[model samples]
Every structure is written in C-alpha cells, then in structure tokens.
Target chain A: MTAPNGMRTMLGRVRGLGSAKSGFAHWWAQRMTALALVPLVLWFVISIISLVGADHAAVSAWAGQPVCGALLIALVIAVFHHAQLGLSVVIEDYVHEEAPKIVALVLVRGLAGLLGLIGVVSVLKLMVGS
Target chain B: MDARKRPLSPHLQIYRWQITNSLSILHRMTGVALSVGTLLLLYWLAAAATGPAAFATAQAVIGSWIGRLLLFGWSIALFYHLCNGLRHLAWDAGYGFSLPSVTKSGMAVLGATAVLTLAAWIAGLVI
Candidate 1:
C-alpha cells in the first residue's frame, strides 16, 4: 500500500518508532515540579526577605518552625528535582557525544541529589537542634 | 554519511531577533543560572544548621558587596524563571498559542519578573 504521497507506506512512516517510553514521564515530572515550586518558592522568597538583617538566632528560629521546615524541605526537593530534569535536557541538547552526554547527565543528577540531601538534613537539624 | 555535507535547516543566525525568540532562550538561560544558584541556598541552610559561628560566617560572606551582586543576579534569574515557567505551563495547557498572545505573554512575564525582583529587594532592604 502506498501512502498519500506515494513515497512510503503509512506503516513504513511510523514503524520502528512509536514511543521512547520515558520522555513523557520526564516531561510530566518537570511540569509537576514546576507547579509545586511556584508556591514553595514564592513563600520562601517572602520569608527570606522578611528575615533580612535578622540574626543567626532569628533565622534559625524561623527555619526551625514546623511549617517552615516542612515547606523548606519541599522547596529544596522540588528545586533540585526540577534542576536535574532541566540540566539533563540542556546537556542532551548541546553535548552530542554519547559518553560525555551520559557523564554530564550523571554528574548533574548526583550533584542535585547531594545538594538536595544537604538541604533536607540541614532543615531537619535546625528543627531538632533548636 | 558525511555529517558536515548534510543539508541543514535554518539556524538561529538566520532568524531576526525578536521578543518571542529572546524570551524563549532567556527561559532556558535563567533555568541554568538558577540551578547553580541553588548552591547558595544550600550553603545558607548548612550554615544555619551548623552553629551560630558558622551562621555568622555565612552571613558575612553573603553580606559582602560581591555577595550582594550575586544575590541580585540570582533573584532576577529566579523571578524570570518563575514567571516564564508559568507562561510555559499555560502553553502546555494549550492556551496562548497565537503569535500575538505569545508576544504579549512574553512581555507580561518580563514585566512581572522585573516588578517582583525589585519589590523583593526593596522590601528586603527597607523591612
């Protein structure tokens, strides 16, 4: 059977390629994280601004609050997850070499995870130590 | 196949600079900047968790001139990324696809980002 253009069959046009299987999950997760980050980041900016010129004790106290700590942990997780997804796309776009692309993707994920862990642990410590 | 000899589509250099194009690229640029800026947030949190002395040192560094500059840049980047990300979400939802809507939304995002960054800084300084 010929396609409308008579160049190839309809199945030939679509065969061997339907879905990558993981692209949608990455995209949906990116959007979900962005949605979560909107409120989290706005609250964080306002809180941090209000704490400007505040002493270490004051800042610690603010961070130690149950609500603040929870939101902060949420923000950190969302930010890093979003960043990892974003940087991975950037690397994939610009880094053509297969090996370097994989390396960069791994490095970005590792760094994002490490920093995110530090943020969560730090917030937890402030809550416990305060 | 010799990749160098392959026919290539029009590249960025072929297009005239425009608001929509600029804003689209700026979104990606700000995203990357904000990614690096996350380190500053992590440092602050780590210091706060450490002790008063460490917190003081962190404050000192952040309070310095260069620190303020970096903070200013990060704040701008954050606001830009946030605003544009919203615009992206709207696009994803299948609204504002027309050329005029796209351009108008781009301008609105820029306006919002500027207002937010400045307002935050002013509030930070005055309050």
Candidate 2:
C-alpha cells in the first residue's frame, strides 16, 4: 500500500534530512567494517606482538604465510575503509562548510584507499618472496 | 536566514563531567589519532617490502625513544578505540541503553583499554 496524498514514508523523511540524501549506507558500511575489524585487528595485534624482536627474515617469513597475507589484506581494506568513515564523521561535524567538507571527505577517501592499496601490495610482495 | 545571530547548543565546558560524555569524546579522539598512526603502519609495510637498509632505517626510527613513546600512545589509542567500538556495537545491537549499564560499560571499556595497553607494552618490552 502507498502513502496517502503527499505523505512521505519513513525512509523518505530520513533521506530528506541527510545532505547527500544517502546516510544509511555510510552508517551501515561503517558498522560492517567495524565488525570485520574486530577479529582482524585482534589477529594483527597478536601477530605483531609475536614478531617483536624478530629479524627481517623472520618477520618476512611470517608475512609470507598464505593465511597471514590474506588476513592482512582483509585487515588493511577494512581498517582503511573504517578509518575513512570515522574521519568523515568528524570532518562533517566540525568543518561547517560545504566546499571544504567535500574536499576533506575526498582527500580522506583517496588517501585511505591509496594507503590500503600500498599495504596489500607490500603484503603480496612479501608473500611472493620478491 | 536568522543564522547570523542564532543561539548555539551549550558546549562541553558548560556541562558537568560524566562517564558517557568523556567516553564519547574519547572515541572520536582515538579515531583521529589512529588515522594518523596508520601512516606509521604504512611506513613499516613499505620498509619491509624494501631492502635491508630500508627496513633497518624504519626499525631505527621505531626503536628510538620518541618513536617508542608514540608507539605506546598509538597502542593505547588503538585498544581504547577497539574496546569502545565494541561497546558501540553492543549499543547498535539494542543493548546497554540504560544509564547504569551505559556507565558500567563505559568504565569497563576504559579499564579494558588500560589493562590491554599495559599488557601490550609489557609484551613488547619482554620480546
């Protein structure tokens, strides 16, 4: 059933309040990434702890493991994505201007994506023993 | 618009201290700190992928006193963010909304963060 004459649906009302008219996706994605990071980050912290005082060869060998590379790649992606989402919230809250806000958001996303790529590539290089 | 002379919401300084309030602010603060710390992670990855000299240079910086201090702070921030993020996830799941529970969880998050951070540092020092 449709809403009566000019009455907005609940979703429609929410969509109206957001600047881009698409707030839910960002909110959901942030939560999803946060959930993914929980286990991945725990693994990362434990692995990093284990690698302490380890030499370059030892650390590289550890990273070269198939499981290690895959998980690290996943962690890098989730982490950067989550970081971008969280930073954008802070920026939007404090920036107070449209132009700079957009610029800051773009920069945050671009830099995060770039650094995430670099992280995955580095892991792959180690995995391939190159 | 009447925005030029509009009233504003009372800011932090005017408010009494509360657990939820401090944790809310700290959640954002830790997030921003961790974003900057990501650069250090990137550097380590890049250094590792490069030759021995590059890795050594990276290690030297990371092993320095200032670097250690930064690392400690970053670790604390990371743990705090992790704990608080989980608390937020619990909130998202429709639990911990009551005032008592919120206060308890907020304190628990902070307590967990401090303990975990100290444990991590001890492990680092030992290994």
Candidate with top lDDT is: 1
Model 2: colliding residue pairs: none
> lDDT tens string, model 2, B1-127?
5568677876878888888888999999999999999889789878888867888888889899998889899999999999999999999999999999999999899899999999988886875
What value does the lDDT take at residue A87 in candidate 1?
93
What is the C-alpha lDDT profile of model 2 across A33-86, one tens digit per residue? 999999998899899888887778887888889999899899999989999999
- Give chain B TM-scores in order: 0.91, 0.91
lDDT of 1 at A51: 89
Question: DockQ scores for all the models shown?
Answer: 0.80, 0.77
Q: What stretches of model 1 exceed 4 Å from their correct place? A: A1-17, B1-7
Give the lDDT of residue B119 in candidate 2.
Answer: 90
lDDT against true structure, model 2: 0.90
Q: How many backbone clashes does candidate 2 have?
A: 0
